[model samples]
Target: MSKLDALPHGPEFRFVDELVSLEPGKQALGRYLVKGDEAFLVGHFPGNPLMPGVILIEAIAQLGGVVAQSDPEIAALKNLLLTGVRGAKILGAAVPGELLEIEATVEGRLGGMIQVSGRVSTAGRELATAKIMLSGEE
Candidate 1:
């Protein structure tokens, strides 16, 4: 059980709404829903409410960010950046009213680069999964 953060997203790009739980690299989960006022979704379909693939990737990255920021292994690093998304898949689509449960567990860390693999689910159904990466400040 975790609560959402009220961080101001740059532009209209708020990817996540909550910080469910984070345990360094071991595990992390977060949640979010589409904001009606979001420009991207406003005309994404005009009538359909699909959480886009890019947003899903962002949600995963956000979780990865939290892990990097909290993990003592990389906490002292001034900056942490989510460096990649697989970029070749749409595991599934998340609907507007669905509560997404995104979970991540650290898979490996090489030097300052950390990798976390995770999945996104809506009501117990997996929507998407990916291996996200982060790099600490040099």
Candidate 2:
């Protein structure tokens, strides 16, 4: 199975489309294409249809998970949980028909807990940023 296939999230909830690069426990880069017909977009803003900020944060967290799971030891620990989100800032809105590029870097790790900082952008412009924390089950 591909690395993404190992993640706990299913197709509908999986935000990561392609893993561009990864540095085991250090960092990861991924991308997703918004096709404008996603189920969640139907009522996100009606006419405007902006991609929600929470989804972007989730995307970042997923990318961070990709990085965290790259380590063999962490991958063995399933069901990683998101412990917290910090310093989240929404600078702009991502619309349908755009390509979302995300990157996450490991900030720290203690036992099964990992801290990561990440950002989401489209067309090279940053749309949001946050620090995501994930704890592996011991």
Question: Which predicted model would earn the best lDDT?
Answer: 2
Error of 2 at 85 (Å): 0.4
Off by over 4 Å in 1: 1-11
Worst 10 residues of 2 by lDDT: 69-78
Q: What digit string (tens of lDDT, one per residue) describes model 1 on residues 1-138?
A: 332332224546757677777776577778776555567766777888677877777777767666655666554344667787663356788766677877767777777787878777887777787887777765
Provide the overall lDDT of each model, using Cα atoms, as 2-decimal numbers. 0.68, 0.88
For model 2, residues 18-53, the per-residue Cα lDDT tens digits are 999888878988998987887889899899888889
The C-alpha TM-scores of every prediction are 0.80, 0.94
Q: Flag regions of model 2 displaced more than 4 Å.
A: 72-75
Clashing pairs in 2: none
Candidate number achieving the greatest TM-score relative to the actual structure:
2
lDDT of candidate model 2 versus the reference: 0.88
How far in Å is the alpha carbon of 27 misplaced in model 2?
0.6
Q: Residue 29, candidate 2: how far off, in angstroms? A: 0.8
